[model samples]
Target: MANDKHEEIDPRFKIANREALIGVGLALFNFIWWFAFAYGLGSKPVSEYHYILGMPAWFFYSCVIGSVIMIILVTVIVKFFFKEVPLDDEGEESP
Candidate 1:
């Protein structure tokens, strides 16, 4: 009877929950940085780097900072909140 109940839950459920939290966190960062760059206060790129792409310095800085922040958040989430579960072949939770 206990086995029957345990068999109803998949090990992947915990993984999915962790992933959903990470997705939501990243989505928030996307919203924040996009708003900052597009509608909020950003560095005034009065100067441009004479690179091959001719991109503004502020844009480059934003990209670097954004990448660093995303990496940090992902690392924190994976390290702190991730849960591991062993599953059976039939998608059942282990005892």
Candidate 2:
């Protein structure tokens, strides 16, 4: 069954699948961090504030600094981990 023609996998498909899984992992990381920040520090009283860049520490880290980090990470991921795959049907064989 493994040798069957129908079981053959394209290299491009494998690359695409890998990239998708990595994207999902990054998204999950972001979600967990956001949830922890929103419920953890956000539950505290207002007078407990420590400011960074004129914003509350939690908001600055979660929204501003986190965004910058994510942007850099995503740029590196796309530049190094992803491949350009042809989506055209020109090379496909028709029965």
The candidate that wins on TM-score is 2
Compose the digit string of candidate 2's lDDT tens values, residues 1-95: 63356325556677877999999999988877776766666678989977888898778777777788788989999999889989865676653
Q: List the pairs of residues colliding in candidate 1.
A: none
Error of 1 at 56 (Å): 4.4
* Candidate 2 C-alpha error for residue 16, in Å: 1.0
lDDT string, candidate 1, 1-95, tens digits: 87665435645765776689879978898668755754332444445333224554445445655677777878887788776656445643335
Candidate 1 lDDT at 1 equals 83
Query: Which regions of candidate 2 deviate over 4 angstroms?
Result: 1-7
Q: How far out, in Å, is residue 26 in model 1?
A: 1.5
RMSD of each: 6.1, 3.0
* TM-scores for all predictions: 0.52, 0.81
